[model samples]
Target: MWAKLVPGKAVATPVISYMLNKAFTYLVNYWRTEDMESVKAELLKMLPHVQAVFDAVDWDNIKEQSAALDAWLWQLRDAVEEAEDSLDELDYHRLKEEVKARDEQEASGSVSKLKGKLIRKLTKHVPKNGMLKRLKESVEGLHKALLV
Candidate 1:
């Protein structure tokens, strides 16, 4: 229904959609993380359901809805915002690692080049375990919110 109004775009494409798009672009053009592939797939699988829920909302009459629904909406919004922030953090770390690697590579001398290569190998730009865990938790939160 929302898609028809937009001619080519779905009106329910909210922060989650943007986050997924950003993650996909980064994975394709800048960073590659095997761990994130599963997470991305989970998010992609949930996207249609999330969009449908969003599209079903009667925004014009939301103010007249039960307090429980209002609360649920707030929770969903918070989860979405948290997910966006986590994605941004991932992007920030990816860019930071990329820049650091580039700077190291720019250093002169064979020793420096070898050291740079070693460092890059040892500290590949994949998300750290802690960040990945947090991201997974965020996705869990989103799933829980949707179930509410």
Candidate 2:
């Protein structure tokens, strides 16, 4: 992976890598799916606020007192790790649906009408309401916490 290309412990790489991974995983699994798209769109809309908070973090100042912020950092790290895992699960479900769709399509012969129907089903993935709500709440919480 790019991890080898990019040195570990580099100042900006970790943040960039983490954000890219999260965005990529989310989009790969949910991009065209209407229900997930709406949720993803909403999250995208809130990125500016999140970016603002991220921009406000003073790494230089934190480094001087890293020990003091250890507990706070740990909490933030845990939250981020949980969020990443949740997002990655989207790909799992997507892959599962892909397999099921393939199986269904294979069982149905190569008729043009059936192919069209298969395409439609493949495109219309159901959204996970709870996950979407949780994601929105998590983003809102971040916005609020950063505001304080």
Candidate 3:
């Protein structure tokens, strides 16, 4: 995915759009249930700053005239990539927990097993504090990059 960001290409819009989509999906699915409200809210808050930064710059012009601006853009891109990776990690853990719950339910051979065990198992896999901290930091980094 990072390879798609060629220096002079019009990559910002697509990358930002994709990140927005992923963030929204997480908000819808996990925001309240997974105790990720703060992290998700911070992410939601930062995204507009990101969009504004992208909007404020004429990247094509900067590509030709300013090596420093090019470097800044790369920094912003790296932040976005980091944020995306954090979201991907959250999704991976969520899916892994779901599959584990399903396997446990099947092994138990009781449909009723799902009601309690699945919820408990799913909650157990809520992103650890370290993961949440990393995600929050990634979003904060992106916000800081936008300020630059």
Question: Which scores greater on lDDT, model 1 or model 2?
Answer: 1
Error of 2 at 50 (Å): 11
Best by lDDT: 1
Write the number of the candidate with greater TM-score, choosing between 2 and 3: 3
Across 1-148, the per-residue lDDT of candidate 3 in tens digits comes to 2224545345555666577566656554544335445544655566666556556666557666677777877887788889888888888887887788777777775666857586775676666656556665676677567667
Give RMSD to native, each candidate: 5.9, 7.3, 5.3
Pairs clashing within candidate 3: none
Q: What is the lDDT, from 0 to 100, of the residue 100 in candidate 3?
A: 82
> What is the TM-score of each predicted model, taking all chains together?
0.66, 0.51, 0.64
Backbone clashes per model, in order? 0, 0, 0
> Candidate 2: which stretches are off by over 4 Å?
1-7, 11-68, 111-123, 141-148
Which of the two candidates, 2 or 3, achieves a greater lDDT against the reference?
3
Better of 1 and 3 by TM-score: 1
- Which candidate leads the pack in TM-score? 1
Cα lDDT tens digits, model 2, 1-148, are 2233223334433463455346445545544344444544554555565555345545555545455454444454554555555555655766777777767777776695487576767776544756645544443343333333
lDDT against the true structure, per candidate, is 0.67, 0.51, 0.65
**Model 2 clashes, total count:** 0
At residue 96, give the lDDT of candidate 3: 88
| Span of 10 residues, lowest total lDDT, candidate 1 | 1-10
lDDT value, candidate 1, whole model = 0.67
